[model samples]
Structure formats: structure tokens, C-alpha cells
Target: MKIRNIFKGILIGVPIGVTLIDSLGYVARVDGISMQPALNPDQDQTDYVLLNKWAVKSYQVQRGDIIALISPKDPSLNIIKRIVGVQGDIIETIGYKNHIVRIPEGHCWVEGDHTGHSMDSNNFGPVSLGLITAKATCIVWPPSRWQFLSSSLPESRLPLNLSPPTLLYSA
Candidate 1:
């Protein structure tokens, strides 16, 4: 009787734990130097961040947000990048074939802070919004590095066209 109850608990508890992680958020390790100073500032020590899946459930993302997504080139791989342009915004490419690109509906331009050393939208073009998995909200590991990630884009990386203000008249 005791063994049977233990087995039952495992089955019930495992699913609930998985559901919470899937719907809420989980910690993920930063692997490469692509994210650079914002992520793995030191080459020797890696950072672990909390990826909030629930925050992006609606597919709404802002420019400068660091997000994780399935690699367009390799479906099996996941990559983290900063959103450079959202739908309808124009982006000037670094080394991409096209000098300028306009993010199409349901697509966003992503790039790594490390630039030349990273593989990102410059190599794959804009990625579909559906590919985005989660937003990195904060660093959870290394107590000294604990802090919320800020959503701020480099002035030079701002999109050519921003969405018009909804309020026509300001006070």
C-alpha cells in the first residue's frame, strides 16, 4: 500500500510541476558569447536567466526585448537575441544581402549584441513571431548578478519607423 501511494504521488506531482514551468517561467543557462555584456559578461562564468513564457503568451513584444526563439536555420536549436525591429518597422542590415529590410507582418528582426560573432537575423532574415519562445526577464543565478533585464535599445539600432502615437493630441 505504501509503495503504491508513492508511485501515485510521483505521477501526479510530475505533471503539475511541468505545467507550471511551461505556463509560467523557468531558468535557462546562457551558453555563448553572442549576448555578450548583457548576458555572459565573463567568458569563464555563465549566467542563468528566468525566461518568462507567460509574459509573451499573446505574442506581443517590444523593441530591445531579449527573447529566445527556435533557430530558423536549425529547427532543433534555440537561440537568444535582442529584438531590433517589430512588424512594420524598417531595419538597416549589417551584413545581410539586403541593405534595408522592412519587417513584415508577424515578423521581427533580431540580432546579437556581439554583432559579427553571432548568428542572428542578419544571417536568417527576420524571424516569424511564432518562433519566439519566451522573454528573458531577469538573471536568477549568481546572487551578485541578480537583477531584472531592462528593455532598452541602442540609439543607433532604433527602427526607422515607429508606431504612431495613439493619442492624437497631447496635453
Candidate 2:
């Protein structure tokens, strides 16, 4: 009876836990130097962030939001990046196919903070919002480095036609 109850408990508990993690959030280790200072600042240490699947479940994303998505270039891989331009925003690319691009509907431009080192939208163009799995909300590992990740896009990377932070503040 004792063994049966334990087995039953495990069966019931496993699915519930999986469902919560799938819908709520999950911890992912930051790999590579792509995100650089904002993420794995020290190559010797990897930062683990809480990726919130529920937050972007509606596909509402904005500039500066760090997101995890299925790699457009290679479906087998998942990549983490920052949202630089949302649908309808015009952006200047670093060295993408087009010098400037208008983010297409249902897609958004993403880039790594380390620029040249990242394989992001800068390399493959805007990614479909459908590909986004989650929004990175904070660092959860390496206690000394733990903190809520704040949304912040580099000034130079801001969308050209959209109001920049400076303009928004000045007006």
C-alpha cells in the first residue's frame, strides 16, 4: 500500500509540475558571449535567467525586452536576444541584408548586446513572434550576479522612425 501510494503520487505530481513550468517560466543557462555585459558578462561564469513564458504568451513584446526563441536559421537551436524593433518599426541594421528594414507584421528584430558575436535577427532578419518562447525576467543563479533584468535598448540601436528615449523624455 505504501509503495502504491508513492507511485501514484509521483504520477500525479509529474504532469502538474511540467504543466506549471511550461506555462509559467523556466530557468535557462546563458551560453556564449553574445549577450555580453548584460548577460554572461564573465565568460568564466554562466548566468541563469528566469524565462517567463506566460508574459509573452499573448505575443506582446517591446523594444529592450530580452527574449528566447526558436532559431530561425536552425530550428533545432534556441537563442536568447533582445528585441530591438517590433512590427512596423523601421530599424538600421548593423550588417544585415538590408541597410534599413521595416519590421514586418507578426515579427520583430532582435540582436545581441555583443553585436558582432551574436547570431540574431541581425543575421537572419526579424523573427516571427510565434517563435518567441519567453521573456527573460531576471538572473537566478550565481547569487552575486542575481538581479531583475531590466528592459533597455542601446540608444544607437533604437528604431529610426519611432520616438527614441531622448525624444520621449524631451517632449
Best by TM-score: 2
Worst 10 residues of 2 by lDDT: 162-171
lDDT by residue for model 1 (38-63), tens: 99998888899999999899999999
lDDT of 2 by residue, 1-171 (tens): 999999999999999999999999999998999999999998799999999999999999999999999999999998999999999999999999999999999999999999899998878998999999999999999999989988998778889997554544643
Whole-model lDDT per candidate: 0.92, 0.93
Clashes within 3 Å, all models in order = 0, 0
> What C-alpha lDDT does candidate 1 achieve relative to the native structure?
0.92
Model 2 CA RMSD to the hidden true structure, in angstroms: 3.7
Position 82, candidate 2: lDDT: 94
TM-score of each: 0.91, 0.93
lDDT of 1 at 138: 98
Residue 157's lDDT within candidate 2 is 88
* Candidate 1: residue 15 lDDT (0-100): 100
